[model samples]
Target chain A: MRINLASIHVDDQEKALRFYTDVLGFLPKNDVPMGEHRWLTVVSPEEPDGVELVLEPDDHPAVRPYTEALVADGIPFTSFAVADVHAEFDRLKGLGVTFTQEPTVMGPVTTAVLDDTCGNLIQIAAMEAPAS
Target chain B: MGDVFKALADPTRRAILDELQERNGQTLFELCTRLISKHGLSSSRQAVSQHLDVLEAAGLVHTRREGRYKFHDLDTSPLRTITDRWQLPTD
Candidate 1:
């Protein structure tokens, strides 16, 4: 099964959409009417038509506590694969993205961690060659 | 229609992941055998296959097609997305 997208609830839809699309280069995949809240989503250009990131509205009662607890506990909600951690890290840094961790070698893979400003610690990594 | 949380929201998927954490890598049959009995699940092979499909689509798991056996393992890339999206401070 191929995952098409990951979803995150946001306090401000427009602001979050801008950060994801304008700042991170994800293209809008879905933006349609959904009662009071619009069904919005985005996808990475690099993985053309790959996973879609669903931008959910944080109107639910659990959102505030969920987002706050995750941040307070320093728990990363998800991760992604990258061809090159250093390059991606540098490129994002150039864009003024604040990183909480630098690239570092870990056992079989080299990885770097960054803050998405949206309340998550995204990791970029270069996976080791497939086990022979 | 993917719920975005379609694959992850299930406790079964989470359990499958917890199992993967220990095994790291396993074929579909292996995972089923190992987990089926333990979880007391009464699903057919097709049902497990469907679940695996969801997991694969979510990018939470990776599968490599080998001759007759498809090897599966956890893919942590989307985990970064979850982490970043959650903005968890790792100090």
Candidate 2:
């Protein structure tokens, strides 16, 4: 049917929580203790009931290699929609965020990629209106 | 110098050089995105990577690793070989 949940494998749950909430400005949606790791998720404040992002753990053997391979080639694990990619890139850079790719115009979209610090590269993008 | 000519023969490789010229340093992902979006190149990532290898062999592109990420940069010094072989007449 419709998508309600999306997920990203983070190396540490606590660090991910802090980065997602304090830095990236996502609100905590769920945090239930499930043995050693908790079912942690965060939602955009603007869309509280929208898709929740699960901060899954990267404890599995395959996850490290998978994430590392993607990072080595500068590929982003997932992309998030933003209103203005250049403005967000500037704001995030002010807060000590490292961007692998600066805001670049790619046809109808402007995009930037940043290191999440949890073993993943996240892309932020914004659509531009067509030229008259 | 022959390798340079061979490398420059491909349209995709030239496009890669153009993007690198626009922005000196770029990851393979950024190059791929530019090629597909700006140049309408339908080449796969692996294919684009192979093209990069060709460029590197010709000394037109150089790849550097900064920590965990790898970036591709353009170096046009090799193109001087052409000028060295042939000189233009002044009026």
Candidate 3:
């Protein structure tokens, strides 16, 4: 089955909109209103026709504790694959995105973690093996 | 916020953070109840306590005691710093 949409819970939809678009550089794809919350979604600028990232509200009572436990244990809520860990790290750092981990190579891959500000720790990773 | 909140890079911690954010001052027992009922997390107090220790060490969570009551408070300045960076000029 092909993946189409993935959702990330946010404390505030507006904040998620700004952070996902401005800091992470994703483009807003859908903004239809859904009662108190909007049917919001974002797409990578490079993949407008590809997968969409839905910014859902963390209104459910369970969301806070679910996210809090993960944060306390130093685990990322989710991860993103980037072209280059070092470059993306520096780029995000330059944009004032705080990183919990630096680009550390682990065999064939490298990874780093950053706070999403809307109550999530997001990891950006990349493959590091040289092409033959 | 980066160094102090390094442990905060986890979603579970973010949720615990909400407890502190909402109540500002809570006992460990209160935190446990919130985690179980609110987030549906089944972690025991010991497991949740460990998370608090990490946050406490990072200065993101502070504790105070008045008489027999022990309270925990969340410091959001560091969290605010993260959002500050993303405050780009909106069109």
What TM-score does each of the candidates earn? Answer: 0.52, 0.96, 0.59
Classified by CAPRI criteria, candidate 3 counts as incorrect
lDDT for model 2: 0.94
Candidate 2 vs candidate 3: which has greater TM-score?
Answer: 2
Candidate 1 global TM-score: 0.52
Decide which is better by lDDT, 2 or 3: 2
- The RMSD (Cα, Å) of candidate 1 is 17.8
- Per-prediction DockQ scores? 0.02, 0.90, 0.03
Instruction: Report the first chain's TM-score for all candidates.
Output: 0.81, 0.96, 0.94
**Taking the tens digit of each residue's C-alpha lDDT, what string does model 2 give over A22-96?**
889999999999999999999999999999999999999999999988998899999999999989998999999
At residue B45, give the lDDT of candidate 1: 61
Considering only chain B, report the TM-score of each candidate against the true chain B.
0.80, 0.94, 0.79
- Best-to-worst ranking by DockQ: 2, 3, 1
User: What is the Cα-based lDDT of residue A50 in candidate 1?
Assistant: 80
On residues A37-118, what C-alpha lDDT tens digit does candidate 1 reach at each position?
Answer: 8899988788767888888888889887886655432334566788778888888999998654456554567666555666
Candidate 2 ranges with C-alpha deviation above 4 Å: A129-132
Q: lDDT at A95 for candidate 1? A: 91
Interface RMSD for each of the candidates: 18.1, 0.5, 13.9
